[model samples]
Target: MVGIGYRKDFAEEFSENTLNPAFIEVAPENWINVGGYYKKMFDKILEKYPLFVHGLSLSVGSPEGIDVAFVKQVKQFLDETKAVEYSEHLSFSKCENAHLFDLLPIPFTEDAVKNVSKNIRQVQDILERKIAIEIVSYYTPIAPEISEIDFINSIVSEADCNLLLDVNNVYVNGFNHQYNPKEFIPKLDLSKVKYIHMAGHTKVASDLIIDTHGENIIDPVYDLFQFTMELMQRDVPILLERDFNIPELEVLQHEMDRLQIIKTNALKQHKHAIIS
Candidate 1:
């Protein structure tokens, strides 16, 4: 099913079309203990639609170690909201005690994989639910001791966690890092894919692309999305992420319609393959 990120900029707009989305993804950090008007608003909406927690501060790859207290708070929030899944970046956002407020690339190494896997296991034990890790977009690799695909595969396999595949990131990283995005798609462990994120990026240069969700979904990204849908043997929740410059709800509804068409077509193709 197609979904969208819940942002306050278009809250009232979303209220009008409650049935348009299959689900809504929210950043737990934004509403963990929110009270008053916003809390009431969210609670009312929660009664209507399912929420998937896409976390911003888990800092899973932090060498400084995972935050136990924060994880407990997240667990409480998830239990309270009945969110179906909790997903965070495979990258780190903190070092030492300082909160960097940005997802940073983790080193592509065996030691880093071990550290991240341990962190995921701890989080899963605390939350009593399987966690999904988003494959992030980075302009540069921190430590290129291993290929990007292998690093990601090892982490999810060792952690025994699900994947939140971000298609735009694949396109951006492929352009900036000089790799075939299509080739990278099949290398992923499709069995672990639970969620998909599709967004637009900015082309600052002929060779550089930034994963900025401010713009509309571009043609190439749409092509990538179609390719992804055609490959998946199972249905996974796909979400449109627009963090800034959000247009009218109607504009988003159009995109949702497009996604529905793609999903329908993909399912037919998958079925034909099975029959053949």
Candidate 2:
């Protein structure tokens, strides 16, 4: 299946049914108190498509610790919306109890692992269901006591949470940090991947890439997503994100159609392999 993030700009597209997204993801914060036109559209959307809730401000790695009150509010939103799934980045967005306004990398240390794991557990306890954590992209490395993949494995293992794999992040991080993106995917526990996110990025320099979901999914990122589908050998619902510089609805849906084709072809190949 293929999906797209809910944005006000796409409201017309949603109303027209010109683009059929298998599901729609929205940040609960965006609709919590919204009124008027958007609220009416949101209600229609809920009645039309399966809603996947993605969060922007969980700040799972915050050293300030998990916000119990905020989590309760999130739970309330989820319950009200009847959201099927919830996901947040596996990075911190606050320090010293103030919002940093960006998802910052957590230090690759055992202490950091413990911090995030405990936080994840608390969130799961409140939500009463497993929440997916997306492997976030960061421009720089923090104090490294372990490899990035190892650190991620540690936290998920300890916390017993699902993963929201982002193919674009893997590609950008591998280019920026100088590693093989293909090799990185195999290291992850893909069985725990509840869904996948694919997006476009900015190539600021020949050697650096920024995970900017502001453009179309470039060929290389599309290739990475295809490779990921083949590697996982299972059909995972994929989402296309265009947070800014979003193109026309038809163009975006075309990208989604390409993703659907890749998934179908990859799974068929896997089945052929099994038959052979």
Candidate 3:
């Protein structure tokens, strides 16, 4: 399936122009405290396209614990949307008094893994739905004890949940960390991947890549998408994230068209290779 990750305000615009069904990524805070605003917005989108809940502040990797208040808000949204899947980033964004407002990496020690796993279990239980974690893009200051893939695998295995598998994040991390994306993608547990995220990023310096989902999906990311599609060996739902640089609806459609073409070509190549 194909979907677009969008904010709530654009529901009407999305309904009018989108030919294929799209997914809505509702931030709970935006809808929860606005006196039924979220409900009204959600109803409008559900009328047009499929909706899915993607949270930004769940802080699943935090040491404190799953935020029950946040979990309730997400559950309410899921109930309203009837979304098949709920997703959040694996990185932590909050602590007692600090809000990073960005995906922060966790130290990949056994203790950190255990704490995160426990928190994830609590979140799943509270939401009463299966949750998938996204692999976030980081700009170093990372703990040197563990590799990125190992850290992700450990959390998934311990939490016993699925992975969102952001392809752009993989490319970003690969470039920043000085590793090959090809070598990294195959190492993860493919079975745990539930949803795939694709977006555009910006190149700052010669070595720095930022996960800015504000532009068209570039060629290198498209190549990685092809590699991921081959690795998965199935037709999985890919969602394009465009949080910033909000362009004309036509531009978004163009990206979707490119993705469809890539998907088709990948399948054809796989079929031909098997036959040969």
Candidate 4:
């Protein structure tokens, strides 16, 4: 299954198109803060396609206690949409009553893992649905006390929540942190992965990978996606994220077509392997 993240302007076109993505990821802030006008538009889109909520402002990894009001509103929105799943980044977006507007990394230590797990569990308890956390891309390196994969695995295991594996983030972190992305994938508990996220990143200095989500899906990430599909051996739902430099509908459609081609070829290869 494959889907795309949508903003308000493209809601009608996406709804009208018969593409029928596996699911659409909605930003809670956009859907709620916009006047009732946008909500009406969202309702119409919901009528046409399945919706999933992916929040950017939750700041779940923040040390501050959860934002009760925001969580309540998000829950209401999720209930109204009957979203297939809800997800937020594993990094913090807020600190000291200010929005950093970036996904900041945390040290990979037992304390951080415990704190994150507690937050995740609280979110699940409030929503009455299991939630998934996405591993984010980090520009700066943190000399974590533990490895990134182990930290993520511990948090998910403790929180009893699913994982939303972001392939682009993995690639970016691998290049920036000098680790092998392929090695990290198999280390993660596959049972906890409910969905996968793929997106484009910017190339910096011809070596660094910046997760800008503004370019086309590159080859290395595509290759990793193929490997993941084969290893998972299941039709996991995939979401293509485009957050900057909004392209024309036709352009996005082409990307979707490319994704479909990759998915088909990868599945065929996996099948052949099984037969052999």
Candidate with best lDDT: 2
Model 4 local distance difference test score:
0.83
- By TM-score, highest first, what's the ranking? 2, 1, 4, 3
lDDT for each residue of candidate 1 in 57-148, tens digit (9 for 90 to 100): 99999998899999999999999999998999999998987889888999999999999999999999999999999999998889679999
Where model 2 places Cα greater than 4 Å from the true spot, the runs are: none
The C-alpha local distance difference test score for the whole of candidate 1 amounts to 0.90
- TM-score for every candidate vs. truth? 0.97, 0.98, 0.92, 0.92
Candidate 1 lands at a TM-score of: 0.97
Per-residue C-alpha lDDT of model 3 across residues 1-276, encoded as one tens digit per residue? 668876654556775665354555555656655657546766776777766667888888787877787788778877866777888888889987466777888776777878888888889899887798999898874555776777889989999988998999999999998999999999999999998888999999999999998788899999999999887777777888888877877787788778878877888888888999
lDDT of 4 by residue, 80-108 (tens): 78888899899888877678878889778
Off by over 4 Å in 1: none
Candidate 4 pairs with clashing backbones: none
Per-model CA lDDT versus the true structure? 0.90, 0.91, 0.81, 0.83
lDDT, candidate 2, 83-112, per-residue tens: 889999999988889987788999999999
Off by over 4 Å in 3: 8-12, 35-42, 272-276
Model 4 deviation from native, Cα RMSD in Å:
1.9
Per-residue error for 183 in candidate 3, Å, reads: 0.7
Error of 1 at 166 (Å): 0.6
